[model samples]
Target: MTNDPAIAFRVTALEDNQPNGREPILGGILRKKAVWVDESLCIGCTYCSCVATNTFTMEPDNGRARAFRQDGDSTEVIQEAIDTCPVNCIDWVKFEDLDDLRSQLNAKTIRPLGLPPLR
Candidate 1:
């Protein structure tokens, strides 16, 4: 693995191996982070794609939004997409905290579609 001394991170290019598209996140010696998209809850609204195109894309088979890579865009931009998801299906997590976050996602808590806005 090649190291970028400036960033102090080991570079592993996913673009060459992954056929689906650009990888969103990159792991390195410094930072450990990840972005997770709940496909079952995704509405395919394209909002996330618009806000953080580099980080997310629609799955070819299901059309739900998916995060192919975590480092394609800035965390702030990706967070905006997560916050704006009408269904609240997107999230960011520490690389080690992914499983814990998954357990907290309960379908019963998901907001129903086309419901009247809160007063």
Candidate 2:
């Protein structure tokens, strides 16, 4: 809670001093790997969406990519999307901390697009 509306995610932890919004290249539980897109730097490249169609989709308004469903594709495929992002705006985050990150981001809550057969 600061008054700044741009900050979306927040976490209050006493013992573990881990940075609240640090984005890891490959971290988090395998079953709960979470993905997020940084709208500021995202060039609206379709690389991620094309690589992981099920996991990512382009926002109609800005054409920026967002993760509609973290589990839409396998972690391996999602990684491909992240790697393919030329601007490197996509991030892999721990699922348990996802809510904290989302809450602090300026973006709205994203609903999972649903689990489909992995592409």
Candidate 3:
């Protein structure tokens, strides 16, 4: 949560490409954006946690990765974690939409180990 504002801004630099027009608020935006891991799509690889220790943690029960702390690490580190996801489950998302994503996650069934259904 104590990440540098510049680094945070660098993370939001992609905000320009997004549809939302939310203006930068310096410190206000430190947690404005976040990385999301779809547990249903998660493969329990733990690469995200390994890359962004502060931001991600592995779930004990399901053995899936979760975004436990928003803005817990530098944006670069979190992005690295996203890139390491072999299943392409991790993604960048708007802060406000998190609740809905969580709701969906809550309703979803985690994909079993070994193989996932074709998209």
TM-scores of all candidate predictions against the true structure: 0.56, 0.59, 0.67
C-alpha positional error of residue 70 in candidate 1 after TM-score superposition, expressed in Å: 0.7
Query: Model 3 lDDT vs. the true structure?
Result: 0.77
Q: lDDT by residue for model 3 over 60-99, one digit each (tens)?
A: 7778899987757767677888989999999999988889
Model 2 spans > 4 angstroms off: 1-30, 107-119
Over 4 Å off in model 3, which ranges?
1-32, 111-119
Q: In TM-score terms, which candidate is top? A: 3
How many Å off is the CA of 77 in candidate 3?
Answer: 0.5
Candidate 3, run of 10 with poorest lDDT: 18-27
Q: Is 2 or 3 the stronger prediction by lDDT?
A: 3
Error of 1 at 61 (Å): 0.8
- Model with the higher TM-score, candidate 2 or 3: 3
List residue ranges in candidate 1 displaced over 4 A: 1-32, 97-119
How far off is model 1, as Cα RMSD? 9.9
Clash pairs (backbone) in predicted model 2: 7-104, 8-103, 8-104, 8-105, 9-103, 9-104, 9-105
| lDDT, each prediction | 0.72, 0.72, 0.77
Candidate 1 residue 85 Cα shift, in angstroms, is: 0.2
